[model samples]
Target chain A: MVRWEPGTPERLQRAALELFATRGFEETTAAEIAQSVGLTERTFFRHFADKREALFHGQELFVRAFVAGVEAASPTASPIEVVAAALASAAEFFPDERRSHSRVRQSVIGRNPALQEREVHKMASLAAALADAFRARGVADPAATLAAESGVTVFAVAFVQWLREGEERSLGEIATEVLGELRALTSAV
Target chain B: MVRWEPGTPERLQRAALELFATRGFEETTAAEIAQSVGLTERTFFRHFADKREALFHGQELFVRAFVAGVEAASPTASPIEVVAAALASAAEFFPDERRSHSRVRQSVIGRNPALQEREVHKMASLAAALADAFRARGVADPAATLAAESGVTVFAVAFVQWLREGEERSLGEIATEVLGELRALTSAV
Candidate 1:
């Protein structure tokens, strides 16, 4: 049996990200990722299904935070307001320290069609989860889905802007800005 | 040599859609689809890259229409308005006769993850194309992408509603309603 240890997952993730950045995601093996951190491949598999998943760590947590925020928002809040709150909650998952890592992760993902497909799938999943959260709050059909999907699109646009080189804004700030722009655009119609 | 005949593509598409609905998308083969239409497999390949493309025959035409609409919109039209016009133009590609086939196509796509991924990729591509169109018209970043993606989200929500059994509204009408809701939702924030 493998012994469970503190910081093992983090170390494995760090090693995997570094390997993916340096050696390319397709070239980096699970064994190499584990060995880089002095862990067994079994331990790596325990933390992630495969190499690609390492870059998507915390996705579930982010989604949960998003849904919880939407649930906790004032019942009187508008759909966009609720979505904004949820995005703000989800933004906590991407702290300043993770920005550089995320940039590299996105770069790696951008280079591979398989990874790009996975990224789109993740975003779609997030939108679906947010829509479910809206439905739980008694919102109607098209509104619930539209607001949730718009939230994801805002998050995507903001995340890219936040990750840009020389950018100093926090993810929450960028998300707020993007959400504002969406509102302005929609309101003009 | 395969005789490139009129209506061959439409016949192949109709045969493929019927096969996909009756036999399931995964179980249906290109050869079977061609044979069902009384055409050779070579004829099918000349029209479609694969079985999946048969269901998505008008995607390119729709995209072209969208871009052309965006290009032809009044110079002073707002980004959202331009996107709305583009969606309206694309709506012409889905006439009343195609509604039943589209409903079946959506159901088939909904049941399969691979097809769902393709659907998301196609939507993303549409948004990218729209954004590029907006950029070509001198619209700036964030606004261009936001409007384009919002257009896609509106299109998706409206398309599903329009496909509901016994629905009376046209795709354009439903899209306008969804876009109106988006405006109301965003404005309330």
Candidate 2:
């Protein structure tokens, strides 16, 4: 019989990130995160499966946006074009306000090998999901998988550039630019 | 005093792969691996940092071949061409004799989330190493990174296809074919 509060998830995430940054991800506990936000451990569990999951709260939304973008694109669009469109649409999930938090989050992830592994797993899952989206649109093998993987690669490169200190480019702009480079590289052979 | 044994590392690796396959990766222990090889735990540690590393023994050789291939390529070659040539050369490291063991290894890795993460990390490290090789060759930032990442992608797709049952194509042949497909895909846009 616990009371539900608005913004509890966001509050927990913010508190977890702060504690992880200050005390390190391995040292931070779910209980400490709950206590920081004046909530119980049960409430925190209601939002996140574990302390590590808090940092990846946006993953589901990002995947959904990417898939939906691919599904909604014109059927006549090429695989790479579909991937580019999906990336552009998914870029909206990371608003400007999240930039500093993301930068901190990347640093936290960078410091821990376990977290780095989790990051790679997440990217692999995203690529698989995007590939499935392509398949659903009747795109065939190899091309679908390649385009999806390339999309994830573009997102990764663009996200890093966007997170750089004092960088002003939007995620969409950077992703498009990176995709263009990929296309140019692929075509160069 | 420890008796030096010839082929201790290779024997331990073979024992580890067999045990990991028969008993499962998580259920297998370092002590068991050492016992199976009639080697001391100290000998095992001298070869591998941990049990997980045994599955990735070829990674160093693979990276060395990739980097050497890139270095040996003509300076005027395009980034994609350099990457393709590197992948083709690196393919020589995975001969037909290793196919069955590789297949088993991939299955063991596929069944475990932690192992899958390790695989992704290994691939990411390879890509980073290739990118560094490109940079050493005087290639610029984004292009070097993009080409390296794309090369890894090509290798992954080709490797999977080459691993299919009844597949007779050599790794180099498969990689070259995949690279050709990538070129067509990119040029189609």
Candidate 3:
């Protein structure tokens, strides 16, 4: 019988990031990552489909956070207001404790072109998902797409700023501030 | 001495598209594309890095159009105005005659996951380039990112609408309408 393993995925993610950082992503093997965490390659495969999946821990949760936030927003709110609420809710996923890990993860993804492409693909998919949520709330075509993309753009810019060295603001604060900047940008028109 | 082949790349591109649409991209070879145009494979490689490059014939020109538009905008214009100017300039590349070819190219890209990733990566790079242009124009921080991304989002949404079957509006018209929609969304804030 397989032994019970609590937090196996989280533990593997930490080990994989550390090893990928030091050894290089292409140079690092799944077996080495598993061995570093005292697990077998089969266990690693069980937790993560592959090496890259380990690097993007909780991606489904991240997507769900945006959708859940959309669902939980006040029904009377405007599309933009609903998007703002959704972003504010998604910010909870990237708490202060997770900032350092996110920074490292971004750095690792930055160094590799394939990883960078995957990151972009994920963001594109996220925008599509957010657009669907907006449409489901009765928002129309171009408006639904615009609100979703705007939400993603604000969140992306804010997340990068939050990752900057010595930035003390939480992700939510940065997102709120960035959302204001977005409004300021539109005001200029 | 090699004979100067006029419209060689354009010929290769047209041939490649026809062949890819019929025979499938994976089944098609460089020699087949080149020979279809009475040129050699070496000539094809000299013009394009690979088969994929044959498909994205004017990507550099497309990118230059955005940057050029940014540079040509009125100096005192607001960030949003500048982005609108930039997109308006870039829209010149997609004339009525190019729409059908674009539809085919997009269909080819839509069918391939790798091509879709490349497309997303290109958009991300375009956003970064636009942000850099905004920064150089004295637009700061989150505002620069917001304007750049908003411009790209508008352009992207407008592009898809323009590509839709039976759609008659020009890309510039669609983009302007979409920008107005974006402004409306923000006005709700």
Candidate 4:
């Protein structure tokens, strides 16, 4: 099994995404990924169980930080405000230097049907986590589910816009703009 | 390979859900499904290619109707309004009589990971179809993608509520409520 060391997991993930996009995910071996990153295959196995796992390793921590941020936000904030706070907190885990790599990773994952399915599962789990957090915070009826899913919508839209802009603006700014568009879209209806 | 006649496919689907929920999706055979519905194995094969497909056939028509409705909506309507109109049109296809069988289908599908994955894929496809419809209209930006995804969210929330209410309310009303909740949540930020 690959053990993920601090910083190494992300480097391996980036390397894997690059290789996967270039060589195709099915064609690229874990050994090739490790060698390209100047790490041993054993180390790669240590970080991720397999190539597929590498694409999703960051999501565990991403979910935790996001839910924490939502739970920690002021109780008085609106549901969307709470979700936006959560997204902002999760955003800290991503580095500015890696936006291009992030875009590449998204593209690679997007092209693969299997990877896309797993991505959907990941998003669903994150929405469930957010809903649970909202429920714990006393939001009832449709608010918890609506806020969680709406937050996911905002995240997806913002991330795509961020990719399209290609470092022209900060991630936070893209997120804000997407949220504004969503607000306008919803309210204008 | 199979083809569904007018009413036979829905009957087979209903029968399959009942058997799947009582035994299991994997444990149930086409013969058993057909026998329960007072049909033959050949008849079952005529309506569904296999057991798994019976669970999913309606989704295609549902998605097609959703896209068509979105495209036919007033161009002046906002993205959210367009989504709402599409959902309303889709809801018309799911009458009160189908809700019980639908809930059974949901429960059966929820018990299996493969079925859940298939469900997610179907939903994603529906979202993609909706996005394409939005793109066909004048609205640009990632609005198509955002609206499509948000429409799925609305559908999910509404479907769950409808399931809980057990045919007490029309699907259209539930969908409208879910859309309103989404709008409220987004605007509250």
Q: Give the winner by lDDT.
A: 3
What TM-score, computed on C-alpha atoms, does each candidate reach?
0.91, 0.93, 0.93, 0.85
| TM-score, A chain, model 4 | 0.84
Off by over 4 Å in 1: A1-12, A38-49, B1-10, B38-50
Model 2 agreement with the true structure over B132-184: per-residue lDDT tens digits: 99999998978888888889999999999988999999999999998888777
Model 4 chain B: worst 10 consecutive residues (lDDT sum): B158-167
True contacts kept of each: 0.95, 0.72, 0.91, 0.77
Model 3 lDDT, full chain set? 0.90
Candidate 3 error regions (>4 Å): A1-5, A42-49, B1-7, B39-43
**How far is A172's C-alpha from truth in model 3 (Å)?**
0.5
Off by over 4 Å in 4: A1-15, A29-50, B1-15, B29-51, B165-167
Model 2's alpha-carbon lDDT is: 0.88
Across residues A1-189, which tens digit of lDDT does each residue of candidate 3 receive? 999765989999999999989999999999999999899999999988889889877788999998889989988999989988999889998889988988899999989987888788888989999999999999999999999999999999999999999999999998998998899889774
Q: B130 in model 1: Cα distance from truth in Å?
A: 0.4
Interface RMS deviation of candidate 4? 1.4
Query: Can you list each candidate's DockQ?
Result: 0.80, 0.72, 0.83, 0.67
Output the better candidate (3/4) by lDDT.
3
Calculate the i-RMS of every candidate, to one decimal place.
1.1, 1.2, 1.0, 1.4
By the DockQ metric, which is better: model 2 or model 3?
3
Docking class of 4: medium
The TM-score of chain B in candidate 2 is 0.93
Compared with the true structure, what per-residue lDDT tens digits does model 1 show for residues B25-130? 9999999999997889999999999988888787787788878889999999999889789889877777778799789989989988888998998888898999
Best-to-worst ranking by lDDT: 3, 1, 2, 4
True contacts kept of 3: 0.91
Regions of model 2 farther than 4 Å from truth: A1-6, A42-49, B1-6
